[model samples]
Target: MLEQKGNLFILSGPSGVGKGTVLDALLKDYNDICYSISTTTREPRKGEVDGEDYFFASEDEFKSLVKKDEFLEWAKVHNNYYGTPKKYVDKTLEAGQDVILEIDIQGAKQVRDKFDGGIFIFLAPPSLKELESRINKRGTETKDAIATRLENANKELEEKKNYDYLVVNDQVEDAIKKIEAIIIAERCRL
Candidate 1:
């Protein structure tokens, strides 16, 4: 049997769609899949580690990377810069390990333009009302922030048709199962 080339899977969705929760569970069960850590200009939040959660970069450092074209995809989101570094992802995929990237819609679109072969999966909330509820439940955002997020969510939901798969996150377990199936099916393709 021939060794298969590793696949790049991009997971994106609205802010409150529980992408993080589903991904955490998925990673716990899957050993072959690798998570791609992104770089950001935002300050590390609460318990987020420097290299694990993200590569925390100063604005100047991030700009230097941009000039050097070190990112597969980068964008300014919510007033902070976020980008996927090209090195680790390229190295992982070349080594035949599947790499998964969780990014926003803007970065996903940028990836689409550059890497057409990657699998794009959109994690959608069960409903907009439910999405709003989830954001509220987080209790980390102000009313104005919540409103802004809802507006952005509305815009993102429209892009679902462009993605290869839509996994509605009504339940975390079910969503993970669906995404796992997607990975399996994609891997099976010749």
Candidate 2:
């Protein structure tokens, strides 16, 4: 039997759609799947670790990486640059370990264009009203920032058809179960 090549799973959605929260729960149960850590220019939130949560870089440093073409895909969203390193992802996938990229909608589109095979899953909120409520409860964004996110979310939801799966994040546990099922089914595919 030939050794199976690793699969790429892209989980993306609009901001404030609970993508981060759902990912936190989903990743805790997996030891084999490699969660791709992205590099970004955004400041770390309260308890986010530098290397674990994200490789936080300065604007100049991020620009240098872009110029070097080190990133598989990178995008400027909400005034911060977020990118995935091509080297790390290539190495992990070649080793036969699955990779899950928890990226935003824009980055996912870029990655989809550059890569041939990947399971694109879009995490969605139950409704726009609920999404706004969740963002407000986070207390992380300013009023203006929240507005911008809401505006962007409206547009992103329109792109859901492009994804292979849409997991609605109305309840965290339920959403996690759905994603887990997707992973299990994908792994068993002949």
Q: Who wins the lDDT comparison?
A: 1
Alpha-carbon shift of residue 97 in model 2 (angstroms): 0.4
Runs of candidate 1 exceeding 4 Å displacement: 41-58, 77-80
lDDT of 1 at 46: 100
Top candidate by TM-score: 1
Q: How do the predictions measure up, each by TM-score?
A: 0.88, 0.84
> What's the distance in Å from true for residue 68, model 2?
3.4
Candidate 2 weakest ten by summed lDDT: 25-34
All candidates' lDDT scores? Answer: 0.91, 0.90
Across 60-172, the per-residue lDDT of candidate 1 in tens digits comes to 99999999989989999889998999887888888889999888788889888878599999999999999999999989989999999999999999999989999999989
Model 1: pairs clashing at backbone N, Cα or C within 3 Å: none
Q: Using alpha carbons, what is the TM-score of model 1?
A: 0.88
> Candidate 2, after superposition: displacement of residue 115 in Å?
1.3
